[model samples]
Target: MQEKDKLNILRHSRHDWMNVVQVIKGNLQLDRKDRVYDILNEVTRRAEHEAKLSDLNTPDLAYKLITFNWQWQKFHLDIEMIGKPIDCARHEMCWLKFFDQFFEKLTEQSDSMTDPNLLVSFHLQETPYIEFDFQGGIQDMKNMQEWLAEWKVSSSCYVENIVANEQELVFVLNKK
Candidate 1:
């Protein structure tokens, strides 16, 4: 199958899964524990299956690597930023794609880690510039290098490391 086709399937699968979750959540608001648990489990199973299908010979291997990392961040990390709007949704989309690529590289370098527990902060000023700061494991030091390299490839924004301390990595981003 074509790469775009596979990506579309993955995106669709996620959308459907979210829809199902929303429905189940709505039903559970009536205090239907049994139905909620059953639906949640089924949804999770299907999501995992679709995720596997999406991973099969994925064209953007970079995307696959960072997929779980982004999932992890979505589940565990806190993000905050301040910036004037410049294609807010598009900028976010750009970041999402870039981060998927960046985090995948980071994950590969942190092979020994089970949980890197990195603390991240983002700051976006005017135009399209933003900054990111990360703190935690030694693994992050290596990850930061790849992040910088990947950041250089983007046309949406310019990224630069303002600080690479023993415990934190700080980066700034601006419009290209």
Candidate 2:
């Protein structure tokens, strides 16, 4: 990462910490102890996710995720860990490629409009698949059909298939 990018990440992270502290301080001053505790709990939850993601042995993937919100994006990404964070060093390119393509498809379909948040859940269970769950601004019927015409997600050990369910689209990365 460039020094400029590192500074940017630090600036955003510091700003977020300051915001949390201010919220807690304000709540305490107002004697809303319960709310303060709730805020702390939520912060802790998010911190745990960050910690695990950082330790997942995939620097490229982790960097992309950590800096995702710092950059201007059509949608914010929320990561959910199903079981434990898997060591993806061996297949980082596979998943990263899939992620890039998925993001491109979504952004391309947006046509300059902002899309909804994307929840990417990692499941390291028996199947060990990563899911990209996106809500809106995906391809319409034509989009899906067009995407289907050229649907092929392949990597060293990752295979992907996309499907639109109701108002959302899910791209699964299966371990092969």
Candidate 3:
């Protein structure tokens, strides 16, 4: 990534942090202490998730996900880390390579006019797996599914697509 792109990501992250602080401040001004506490708890929960994601020992994967919002994609990306963090150093490349291709397909097949979001959750505890939950429209649905199936067949990871259609595409990947 270029230095400019790196700076842009920092700017975006800073904006989000500012928004959080503003919300908290606004609630305090309104004397809504309960709402302020709720917001703080949510912010702390999200921070914990981010810390767990960083603890996975997958720097490339972490960078890809952390900077995903800076890219030119139609959908917003949300990355979540669930359960205890596990060291995934041995499988970082495999996971990174898979997402590199998967993201391409997501952008190429997605509808640019619609506002959609993709939630990617990393289940890192026992029976670890990655979940892809996309809510949006895909232009070339068949091609996307074929690409996923091809990758699954050729790769060591196991993939199960629960739903693949125009409105949504949900799948899970687990190392074998």
Model 2 C-alpha lDDT per residue in residues 1-176, reported as the tens digit of each score: 69997897789999889999999999999999999999999889878787777877888888788778766787777887778777767767777876777677766664335357788877766556778777766546477646644545332444456676546666676766
Q: What is the lDDT, from 0 to 100, of the residue 66 in candidate 1?
A: 31
Q: List pairs with backbone clashes in candidate 3.
A: none
Q: What is the per-residue lDDT of model 3 for residues 25-96, given as tens digits with 9 covering 90 to 100?
A: 999999999999999998787778778888899988887787677556778888888788998888788788
lDDT of 1 by residue, 82-175 (tens): 4322234445556566656555554554433344444333333344454555554445565566557776667876676567655555677655
Better of 2 and 3 by lDDT: 3
- Assess the local accuracy of residue 79 in candidate 1 as a C-alpha lDDT between 0 and 100: 37
For model 1, the local distance difference test gives 0.53
Residue clash pairs of candidate 2: none
Per the 3 Å backbone cut-off, how many clashing residue pairs does candidate 2 have? Answer: 0
TM-score of model 3 vs. true structure: 0.82
Error of 2 at 18 (Å): 2.1
Highest-scoring model, TM-score: 3
Q: What's the residue-level lDDT of 157 in candidate 3?
A: 76
TM-score versus the correct structure, for each prediction: 0.43, 0.78, 0.82
Residue 99 in candidate 1 has what lDDT? Answer: 58
